[model samples]
Target: MATQSPFPFLDGLFERIAQGPRPPDWLVNEAQQRLVLLINHVLMQERAATERLIPRKGRVVRVQWRQFFVALQVTPAGLFDLAAQGGTPDLRFEVTETSPLGLAQAALRGDRPPVRIDGAVDFAGDLQWLADNLRWDIEDDMARVIGDVPAHTIASVARSAAQALRGFVRKSGAAAGGAVAPWSGNGPLP
Candidate 1:
C-alpha cells in the first residue's frame, strides 16, 4: 500500500504557494542579491572552495526549480556575481523534486534533493566537490558577534534540537514504510 501524507493539507498549501501570484521583480532581485552575498560569505570561509571555483571564472551557472531560478557567474576572484539576463549558462542544475514538504523532509534527513545537472563536466565536478566538502561554520560566525561562550552554548542547544528533529523525522519515515527514497546521487533525478 502507498503511504499517505500524515498532513494531507500541506499538499494543498504547497500547491497554493506554487500557484500564488509571483513576488514583485524588485523583491525577487533583492532576495537573490542577498542569497549571493550569503553564498559568497560561506565561500570566503573556505579557501579550497574559492580555489576550486577560480578556474571556472566567467562561467555562468543557473539553478532552477519550477518557475524560480537564479543565474550566477563566477568571477576572477573566485566569487560569484548575478549573471546578466542574456548570458547563456555554462552549467545548469534543476532540482527535480516539486513538493516543498518532500524537500524539507529530505533536508531534515540530511539528504540532498534530487537534481538534474547538465553542463561542463569539469565545472560540475568542481561544484560537486564543493558541495561535498564545504559547510558554513555557523557557530564560528556567531562567535564573532556574540562572545565565544554564549555562541557555543547557543550552538550546542541548536544542535541538540536539530538532532531531536532528525530523530523524529527518521521514525516518521520508517513508520510510513519508507515512502520517500533517499537520494544517492547515482540515480536519475526524480
Candidate 2:
C-alpha cells in the first residue's frame, strides 16, 4: 500500500519557495564566502586532504541546487576561494533532489542525495575520494574551544541525540512504506 507524508503541505511549501525570487546577490555572495572559509578550515586540519587538493589547484568547481549556486576555485595552498565570475567551471554538480524534507531524511539516514555530475572524469574521481575520506572532527574542535571534559560530555550528549533521531527517522521511513531503505553505511552513493 502506498503511504503519504503526514505533512503533505511541506511539498507545496517547498515548491513555492523554489519558484520564489532568489535572495539578493550580495547576500548570496557573502554566504558563499563564509562557506568557503569553513571548507578551508576543515581542509587545513588534514594534511593528506590538502595534499590531494594541491594537485587540483586553480580548478573551478561549481555546485548548484535550484537557483542557488557556488563556484569555488582550488588554490595553491590547497584551500578554496570564490571563483571569478564568468569563468567556465571544470566540473559541475547539480543536486537533483528538490524536497527539503527528503534531503533532511536522506542526511539523517547517512545517504547521499541524488546528484548529476558533469565535466572532467579525473576531477570527479578526486572529489569522490575526498568525500569518502574527509570528515570534520567536531568533538576535537569543540575540545579546543571549550575544555576537554565539558567538550567530551557535550559531544556524548549530542551523539546520543543524533542516534535517537536517526532511529526515529528510520522507523518513520519504514512505516511510510519503505520510501527509503535503512542505511547500512556501505550502500552505494546515489
Candidate 3:
C-alpha cells in the first residue's frame, strides 16, 4: 500500500467526459494513460508469478504474439494484436480483467470471476513502457473474459480500470502504514 495524490486531473477528465460533448484530445490522452497503467500493473504481477513458476534454466518459451498458451486455445498468454510487435503467437486465450479493488469487493460477496489468481507484488520501480514485462505471477484474466477467444471488450475495460487505478494511486498515498516520501521528495516523475 502506498500513499497517492488526489487525481484532480482524472476527476476533471471523467467529469468532462460525463458532462456532454467529448473532446477528442482529452479522449486520446485518457486512452494512452489508460493503456500505460493497465499494461504496467498486469505485467507487474505477471512478472512476479512467472518468475516463480518458470524455472530459470536455458530459457522459457518466449510466448510470441499468437502462440498456443492455454490447453484449449492456440493463442498468446494474454490479449495482443498482430499490430502488436513480437514474434507471431502460436495461439490465443480469453482474458477478463477485474480491477484489484473491484476483485476484492467481489471476493467478499462470494461472486467470483471464472478464474482467479492472487499475489503480493512490490511495484515501486516498474515502468509502463516494456512489452515483455508482463507479470505471470498473478492470475491471467484472459481465459475468463471470453469462452474460447480473448475478448477485445475485456482488454478495453482492463485498460480503463488500470488508468483509474493509476490516477487513484497517483493522487492517494500508501494507507497510513507504508513508505513515506519527504515533503520535497515529490520533485518529478523520472
Q: RMSDs, each prediction?
A: 9.3, 8.8, 20.0
Assess the local accuracy of residue 152 in candidate 1 as a C-alpha lDDT between 0 and 100: 99
Tens-place lDDT digits, model 3, residues 1-190: 9766587467477656544564476664465456545644564455553343233212112221111121211113332212233433223222243344444434433354333222212221111123235443222455554532455556667768877755544444354233222235476632
Best by TM-score: 1
TM-scores for every predicted model = 0.84, 0.84, 0.21
Candidate achieving the largest lDDT? 1
lDDT of 1: 0.90
Better model by lDDT: candidate 1 vs candidate 2: 1
Residue 88, candidate 2: C-alpha displacement in angstroms: 0.4
TM-score of 1: 0.84
Candidate 2 lDDT over 23-141, as tens digits, reads 89989989999999888888898898889889999999999987789999999998899999999999999999977767888999989999999999988898898889888888899
